[model samples]
Target: MRARSTVLAACAAAVALLPAGCGGGEKADDAGASASPGAASAAPGPIPAIKPADVKPLVGRWVGTAKDYFQFTADGSGVWVRGGQRLWSGTAIPEGGGKYRFSWQGGDLKTASYWGVSLTEKNTKLLFAGTNQTYTKAVAHKGKGKG
Candidate 1:
């Protein structure tokens, strides 16, 4: 249980620093917005089905904050990095129909934790089902045209 708590703490810290990343300066929506105090809010619309092509485009670094991010490689591997250190890595498998299953091996677990994941906002953001966290893709820059 201690291991789970540590992992949860890492995720919490990542969310707590979201206002300062590649997210375009917009405030993050409340993680638990459904429970926010106000007139009852409508449920969010259904997420679009993930496509097989969507898997390839996920091969890059996605950031929630300067110190927290997820990186995926074309070799079907993904890593979660925090505080400039790699925290864990796992296999990313396509379950077809644009859905992906991530089986990560880390911490105290003898088995892997599998989670459904998908891309949103035109593939600019990564969203994991059953969770409110979102990570924005890091934009790549090219060198200035040679003189």
Candidate 2:
């Protein structure tokens, strides 16, 4: 209870620092009218099925905030890095229809973790369990006019 109170107080303090109710209220409708308070939110769209080709595009280096790195190889092998150190290495198996079952030996989730496909963003997939966060693909830059 004490920890909860402290966290709530911190959140309240943080919210107070922001302007006017922490950016809530007065959501606009599709017809350019204000939505009612406590109105039902829009439903999320369906997750698309992933293909082997989709997984192929993700076979590269990906970098996220705080030195988080994700790498996938063509030969069903991959690596995860944090703070310039190897965090996890495992094999990725395709379960058909754009989903992958990640299997790691000694890591966060030992058994397996389900991954879904994002058609809009080809490089990254949604982590369904443990934590919900998007892992972004790392972009490589080349010198101008130098192959």
Candidate 3:
């Protein structure tokens, strides 16, 4: 009898807590419920693609604010450095349109998408669509030649 009573109590408690455990309130509209004003709730818009030949210009050091930068090589590998420390080393493979798939090295093997390289005589910019970050090409510093 005691065992049966304990079982009944447990079942009652579970039933009482079920509603709270789930999102058991009034249903909210799909659009307005979760999204804040002026915020994007859906995926971002498509980025413009560039030809494969255009990717050649991307092979160089690009710098961002706070010492964050990326160094890409002709072989398609690159490294992401932030605050003078190497954070992620990966391969930026051109995906045939302006997009490049940045595949990080390691067990996790995370990947990011980058596109939109705008180049001018004085400046070059690479846009990372995921975070909406833009990195400018870093000009090589010239040293004084031996006199």
TM values, all candidates: 0.52, 0.47, 0.48
lDDT per residue for candidate 3 within 34-62, as digits (tens), equals 32112224322222343445467778998
Which residue runs does candidate 1 get wrong by more than 4 Å?
1-10, 13-54, 106-116, 129-131, 145-147
TM-score of 2: 0.47
lDDT of 2 by residue, 1-147 (tens): 775565445434432332232122112123432221122232212223334464686577765444455677776456655566554455455555545554422111222332222212543553322223355676687778956
Query: Each candidate: RMSD to true structure?
Result: 14.8, 17.6, 20.4
Model 2: runs farther than 4 Å from truth?
Answer: 1-54, 106-128, 144-147
- Which residue pairs clash in candidate 1? 50-98, 51-98
Global lDDT of each model?
A: 0.52, 0.43, 0.48
Error of 3 at 133 (Å): 1.0
* lDDT of candidate model 2 versus the reference: 0.43
TM-score of candidate 3 against the unseen true structure: 0.48
**Model 1 residue 36 lDDT score:** 14
